[model samples]
Target chain A: MTSLILYTPSGVLAKGGPLKLAAKRLKKLGFDVAIDEAALAKHLRFGGEDDVRLEAIHRVARARPGIALATRGGYGLTRLLDRLDWSLLAASVEAGTRWVGYSDLTALQMGLLAHKKAPTWWGPHACDDFGRDELDEVTPDCFAEAMTGALEAVGFRTESGFDGLDTRGLMWGGNLAMLCSLLGTPHWPKVRGGVLMLEDVGEHPYRVERMLLQLHQAGVLASQKAILLGAFSDWKKSPLDRGYTLKTVVAHLRSLVNVPVLTGFPFGHVPTKVTVPFGVKGHLVVQGRDAFLGWDEDHAHHHPGHDGHGHDHDGHAHHDH
Target chain B: MTSLILYTPSGVLAKGGPLKLAAKRLKKLGFDVAIDEAALAKHLRFGGEDDVRLEAIHRVARARPGIALATRGGYGLTRLLDRLDWSLLAASVEAGTRWVGYSDLTALQMGLLAHKKAPTWWGPHACDDFGRDELDEVTPDCFAEAMTGALEAVGFRTESGFDGLDTRGLMWGGNLAMLCSLLGTPHWPKVRGGVLMLEDVGEHPYRVERMLLQLHQAGVLASQKAILLGAFSDWKKSPLDRGYTLKTVVAHLRSLVNVPVLTGFPFGHVPTKVTVPFGVKGHLVVQGRDAFLGWDEDHAHHHPGHDGHGHDHDGHAHHDH
Candidate 1:
């Protein structure tokens, strides 16, 4: 049976309705779920104090479960980056522990990439998405396939602009605000020739423009092969915004940078979300308005002659469609 | 005659009530006040379109008035930084144009320092402070003194502990969010051993801590001589937070970083404010609970045996009490 560890590295699971329901579903789906003792420990707005959250991470690293899933995401992992035992986390990754979550988890996932070049999932958190009463068919299926090493690619419908697009590079990026927070810090991975995917929740178009400009000004956008926009939902519009929007911001960025930015990515804070791996070689191909991101267990086909430290060599390689 | 240019570079001046009143007051106080044509122009939330705002800046640079004051501050200058003519502004600064304003102006002022080490005043905007029904005594007095070269120092009370302390460095920093926006960009000034002063409005203590942590992680705070925190006001506390406040955030930062974090800075979105010169040598001395920040027009006294731009060799040196 697949073993999983339910950890809380962000805000406390006050009610944890989704937590209990998600565990029940995971058990029904034939996975052994172990709830961490500190998962519900509350210290004000956080899951626990900084030391408590840090200890949860270290404990998961030592346990090396099949999946280390966060109970929720609010704001806490950033406080632990400087003091985290990255080597132990890297060891857990080597032992086949796949860290999963998004939102605030972007900090830890990005930190892992910057320090150890280890891979994590930019997917659903335990409570927020998976813990719901009616779990979406797409989310659970994709997650299960990805976990069982049966999923290799995700196809989505996008706007038809880049017809003959073909590129393969390291897949990276998560929540935009969290990504912006990591800028200039040691945790920001110096990625080049990457397929960067981005999404956010509850951010205005102007604020989104500001964060995008920050990345553009830092030369990060220009260095990437392509930018895949997932979702920017739950933002309020001001009467002051005559015609400005996320589309306008995207158009302005496209006009400024040479990088191709594609939209209609089915990820981010949404009901039907797609699960994708971070810090791995991803092959992107655009056929008309359709885009596909695929990877293989063997890095030979997707990333030829690339000797990056992030390349997992344990041979879990297989094609999933 | 003391000439001033009232321009709008950020949000729209919907009603010219404050703008007109401010001009009338300045005229009464003996100054040639010329309002820019675009000062009242409105476009969505901005003072004007990007090109219009850019033209206003260039026009002011060419005119080189005694003072260039912004009408109000919201959020717009971040868009114009890359397209701004920094050299022209720097030349205007050399010609003794005291570019003044705070809030959003922090972007332009910090950009000026990053590009050419020119000085600006972190003072009140035209409509926001001066145009009010009654201006605060401290507000106009500090602005007048700083503008007329009579303001050499600012003194305030702080928590007791840091007494008999004496240090000096280049005075810098404004608007914590704006400063963080410039991180990892070409516009971020590489100031070592500098005295950084920061303040903001409507940001939670967690966000304040996050930005501070970003600076600390980027090796910015640790490189400074001291950190002077101005007001962080008008923010509401979340019910989730037990007892955390801005003071708690400061205490946490002081515990982590080995820099003197002093408080009671009378700046930011407050009625009683202090205007100080940016990019100038600042002499900091703490006597009991009283802290003073003094600077001379001649950098020789405070910043001895150091020459990396911003030194006025023309010798406009005068001490103000």
Candidate 2:
């Protein structure tokens, strides 16, 4: 049984019920879940005071559990980025501790990539995805298999125009807003020719377009082989937005950049998100309307000069066809 | 007679009533006001298509109006930054045109600063301010005085802390979100030891803090002389935010950086906003809870190698005490 430690590193966990339920479910899934002492701690809107949360993170990293999962994601990790112990987290990664979560967790994952070239997972949060009244069938299954090294490829149905689109690059990116927030910062990972994945919730289409345009204008899109757009859900349409919609936003983005912008990846602030490795070399292939992102663990382990820490360390490594 | 042009550069003007009313009010304030040809044009949510808006910007620059005021600010100018003719706009600035507006206009203003070292104004829009059903007396008065070079300073009350404090630097910045969007982009203005002013509407405190943290972590705040925070309005309180407020956000920011963070600047998306120069050398003085920002036009005019386009050309020029 793999040991998993659940902690709250971001927003305040309002109630303990969801966390308990999540632990129960994760335990049933053979996670051997152990909740952190400050998992239910609160400081205003954060899980704990800045120092407390920071300590909890270092604690989890020191424990070197098989999985270090966040209870939920709201708005806190960016604050901890400057003071975080990256070496400790990276050492834990070397010890086979798979840090998993998305949303606010993007900050940590991106920081690890920028500082130590370590990989993390873009997957479900404990409270948000696993602690639901009813468990999502695909989320936990995908997460468990990925943790156990049994899952290699994840496929989804994207828009049609990318039928012959076969490309390989470092897989990176998470919540669109979180990614934008790290721009120009020391924690920003300078990954070129990478397949960027992005998703967001509650952001209007115009806001989404603005963020994408920021990435585009900053020349991030041009450096990438492909741009994978996941779910941009929970946005409200304004009365002033006559014909302006997400479709139009995507069309405008496509017109602006030469990079292939593929949509409809199963991820984001949605329930059925796939567990994808954040810093792994991924091979993306498109057949008709179906898209697949696959990675080889053996190749990842043999990365040059890396300690073979369960995932690829070099984001610049090219996959030989 | 000073010539002013009212044009729609960003969001669509759903109704013509506000534009007409704004024009009438500006004319009453003893200026020749001309509404742009496509002031009322609509394309989805923008004032016009990208080319249309871009052409309108160049058109306004060619006209060399005393003031080129945006009709409104929503979400469109970021698209036109790459295509904008910076030299033409700089020539217009040299010819005595004062470009003005806040919110989305921050993109255009910051671009001018980055590309041509030209100054713009962080001021009002047509619809949201002057065209209100009940006009704000202070807003129009400040605009008129700032336009004719009659107003040397604007003062406001702030929390008592920095009495007898005096500092001078280049005055810059506008809407917070717009400023953050330009980070890591070519449009970003690299201003050091400058007074950075910021404000935003409808963004939660946590979001605002995250953006501020991005700036901080990117080494932006550490280089600034002082930070002037204006009104951050219209954000709703969530049940999860027990005691998390803008006050707490400011406190957190102050703890992270040694720079003085002063509040109560009379700007932002409010009715009673003061028109401030965006790229001019400003002298900031504080005495007993009262703060004043003053600029000398003569000093701004004699800048080295600069045509002295009504504002300072160099953001790095230190003010001799």
Candidate 3:
């Protein structure tokens, strides 16, 4: 039984034909899927949306063992989250399941982490899977091995050295905007010594810089061990925008802290994304002669859909988390 | 010398021009004025064209004591703030100078509070004086009294009753856009029991809602005594904008917390703004009756220009804040 459920909030994806087909593809991949249309309908302010969404959650939770996935990404999840019974979902996940998605799906995932320590994955969803054409063998191998817990993630090794080298800590982070909203709240993990990862879409470079500065200024960046820059794809600078550029943001980040700041990774609002298990454990190593992709059973991974996989971890290939 | 300095980082108010003449008018009404084009230049990134604007910070610190005011607002202050000598500025005013202005001026005031505990005022500036063609006497009287410490802020009563309200704290806030940027940053105050005041100009209703949500989600709106929605003057609901309306935003806030939410008041990016003293100890009464404001000062009123007269301590005043 491959554990996977598809949930949609904000109808941005639920009603979209393309998104529906996106779910079918996931179904074809071999996973149980479900969509919380009520959560999606909340945006429309329609009656009975809550009941509809609640039914979807119950179906997924009762699925015995499965990973819950978001159907699509847009805006509206923030509203539904406050009212949802997160603990109920958590109890089901603990029984046997995980959650995944990014983009606006971030609000749900981060909320879970903040509200209940419900472990989740920052990866592709029903509609935005990193296609085979898009990801090479190594990347897929990396994904396959991670879900099945065949590998432990040895975080990024920045090309640039940690300016004031010699520091250690746990790891944490996610979509930039979501992470910013977490600051000052109980949701923000105590990421001291932890590798801090960040990536976002739809924001200009300056807004990105402002957010980074906000984090740094708020004491999060200063507390982290090594800061990792994930995939910031297609995010561009506004033509008339005179604010910070990506390079400038990174440069400024490096200048502000003694910690190592590295880029050229894929863990944000991108197509070829990785399922990063934040707050677990990881190390920041420079991509030198010592750097190579590797994965083991320590980090969890999963096949698309499998009503028959069971609690077995041996089937997952090894690459790196 | 009057300890108030009229500081404008972005917009330049011509000296002896319309703006300076206006300041002279205020000064004639018994208020002291100090305009630092250099500080304003630094604030506006006066890189070259206005090279004289490159005057150093010790100079900014050496301000001729009076409410340090911004000429007009633009956008270069945040950039220059890091280079600002906050300690020196405070040292320059051993007593305390009430910093005032809104919009672009918010960055400076927030920076001051963030860098160190400096009292800042969120209100009108020199240009506002010109707009008071009809309310000239009242404008200059309040401006002079506020600057010279001759004016005593009276009681604050909101039309929205203070019922169910049982709290008191300092009142703080400026522009909504400014608040968004400061989230998760050291620049934000510890809004506990604080009467959270918000205002903005040109922002669409949805944008305002987004910002308010950002504040609420960020946890700033959690424990505040009351949420005060200030003038949304010129605010629009974009023809193409989607999501929540300002009213919905207010309702959403009320739904999330038990705090009293009040609206329809002045104190945004408008002229004739009330000089709000941020960081001072203020009493907030949200009950249906007797909504009072303003902090108590043992010295009450101090003057650098002329006789201190305006004495009213109920904290009530009908001016923008």
Most accurate candidate by TM-score: 2
Worst 10-residue lDDT window, candidate 2 chain A: A307-316
Kindly list the per-residue Cα lDDT of model 3 for residues B70-147, writing each as its tens digit.
Answer: 556544444454566677765644555555677766766666666665666766766544423444344454555566
Task: List ranges where model 2 is wrong by over 4 Å.
Answer: A299-321, B299-321
- In model 2, what lDDT does residue B152 have? 57
Candidate achieving higher DockQ, 2 or 3: 2
For each candidate, what's the DockQ?
Answer: 0.52, 0.78, 0.25
- Provide the TM-score for each candidate, comma-separated: 0.91, 0.94, 0.74
Mind sharing the TM-score for model 2? 0.94
User: Best candidate per DockQ, number?
Assistant: 2
lDDT of 1 at B74: 83
- Candidate number of the best lDDT: 2
What is the lDDT, from 0 to 100, of the residue B255 in candidate 1?
88
The residue-by-residue lDDT of candidate 1 on B1-321, one tens digit each, is 779999999888779788999999888767799999899888777889889999998999999999999988887898898899999999988887888888889999999999999988898888999898978877776777667765677788888989987989899999998899899999998888989999998888888888999999999999999899999989888876767678778888998889899998887888777878899989888889978788765531122232222111122232332
The lDDT-based order of candidates, best leading, equals 2, 1, 3
The lDDT values for all models are 0.83, 0.86, 0.56
iRMS, model 3 (angstroms): 5.0
The recovered share of true contacts, given per candidate in order, is 0.64, 0.90, 0.29
